[model samples]
Target chain A: SQQGEEDPQALSIQEGENATMNCSYKTSINNLQWYRQNSGRGLVHLILIRSNEREKHSGRLRVTLDTSKKSSSLLITASRAADTASYFCATDKNTGNQFYFGTGTSLTVIP
Target chain B: GAGVSQSPSNKVTEKGKDVELRCDPISGHTALYWYRQSLGQGLEFLIYFQGNSAPDKSGLPSDRFSAERTGGSVSTLTIQRTQQEDSAVYLCASRRPANTGELFFGEGSRLTVL
Candidate 1:
């Protein structure tokens, strides 16, 4: 499958700590995006890093991409209970508009 | 709607029945997508629509699953002869035609087949 896969299916962290999740895909991509889903419903876009870029940061979230390795990682600094959610990585391949998503990482922040 | 909107947030039906899910994408967005997620599972790509171009239904699991985007705006996903395995949350998302590639999603429609 061309879908991406996330490592460490689940993670738990204390408030003020940092949480990290990694994703690996199998094909060339135009860009990679991170999304957060609360209560298993809609997913909210977090960040996007083009294949040409190595890293990008948005607010408390930081994303890094290594196209040669076909891997990407997301780091949430100063985690909070409200940040508990499933994080997904999506890849937009160079050939199409469809974005394939990863299995996702479930995150829990202890208050 | 300020964001993508979906109808019938939850639905329960018997096996062999047919069901349709609706999605209203954010106005002016030209790209729309459908995905299904089972409990504790990853999102499964279903279909994609980009403006007036023909939809890419390559990810559809079977002929029993089909989707249509009308006038490049609203979309509908139909499931025929539903099975227990078809019980899942169907999510819809839309994106602007710009290069950002960010997708805005709806709350999703949950379907249960018994």
Candidate 2:
């Protein structure tokens, strides 16, 4: 079973709008990471938030984590058409080194 | 040379046949991972290898699936007596075990069983 589940399976918005996606996991994790995938291609690493950290930012991306709730969110500011892709959240459990991924959120940006 | 590379970008084989997918990790990477993704579904972990340690095969779906990494760099996933259910994109990723945070992914091999 997938360790994480993402909400809002699909979203559509115009360029320059901000997009938010949420992820919930089952167990304690050492860290959580986000990735983006274009159609039929490899996934690209976006941002990683450690269990000890509550929030992180990278350029236009912002990530927040709440260990107590076992959930996380990724926010993209000033979204662009190129940001249209499937976004996945991956979690690495504290006990194991392997990481499990969520179902993912598909975002479509209208130019 | 700089990123993970997977071979046989696309494959088509008949049922009951065997297929092999290969992955080459980035130079000097210590951890290698294999995952399977069905259309519009989440990635399913298959196997993982770190350094010379024993591989984690807990995620492999069945005995028909097997993977091997040589020199801790290149890995191959082989499936025997393939079935239509085995059709999916197989992705390979690599990272430094110490980091345990980010992973670099390959373009993946799309397998289709007829």
Candidate 3:
């Protein structure tokens, strides 16, 4: 069973615009991490926000976690064509380290 | 290896045939995981290995699916009597310990069941 659900299945935007993706999970998590995957490749870890931490930033990526709502969002600022790819949210429940993944959000930055 | 490694980047097999996928995790990572991703679908967790024992094999879809990690380094996922529905990309990931650290993944094995 999928533990998380991500919204905006697909999004297209011009370069320099920002992209936002949201994910919601059902259970309490040790940490929520965001990952990026290019076509035909494996996932690349982007950032991890602990349950106690509300927000985290890395490069142009910003991740916010609201455990109260069991939801999290990923925001990409100054999006570029190279940022075109699929983004996924993985939640590691406090009970274990196994991370459950969401369906994912596909973003396309048009140059 | 600096990162997790998987073998036979692509495999095409006939129905009823058996297949084996291999994963070699980073040097001393004690945690490893297997996941399956179908066409444009989310990753479905298959199993997780802590050292040589698997505490969670609950995500395995059927009896045909099984995985094992040896020497706490290399792992293998085996599927018996493959079915068309089993065709998917098998991904392998490894983490350091009992931490919520990020998982490092392999390129993945694309299995095609015909």
* TM-scores vs. true structure, each candidate: 0.98, 0.98, 0.97
Candidate 1 docking category? medium
As for candidate 3, its interface RMSD to one decimal place is 0.9
Q: Tell me the tens digit of each residue's lDDT in model 1 across A25-70.
A: 9999999999999985799999989999999999999999999999
Q: What is the DockQ of each candidate?
A: 0.75, 0.85, 0.83
Ranking by lDDT: 2, 1, 3
Write model 1 residue lDDT over B1-114, tens digit each, in one string.
Answer: 899999999999999999999999999999999999998878999999988999999999989999999888999999999999999999999999865578899999999999
Lowest lDDT sum, 10 consecutive residues, model 3 chain B, at B47-56
TM-score for predicted model 1 compared with the true structure: 0.98
TM-score of 3: 0.97
Rank list by TM-score: 2, 1, 3
lDDT (CA) for every model shown? 0.93, 0.95, 0.92
Clashing pairs in 1: none
Off by over 4 Å in 2: none
The fraction of reference interface contacts (C-alpha pairs within 8 A across chains A and B) present in each candidate is 0.73, 0.90, 0.76
What would the per-residue lDDT of candidate 2 be over residues A1-111, giving only the tens digit for each residue?
537999889999999999999999998988999999999999999999999999999999999999999999999999999999999999996854799999999999999
What candidate 1 keeps of the native contacts, as a fraction, is: 0.73
For model 3, residues A1-111, the per-residue Cα lDDT tens digits are 537999989999999999999999998888888999999999999998989999999999999999999999999999999999999999976765679999999999999
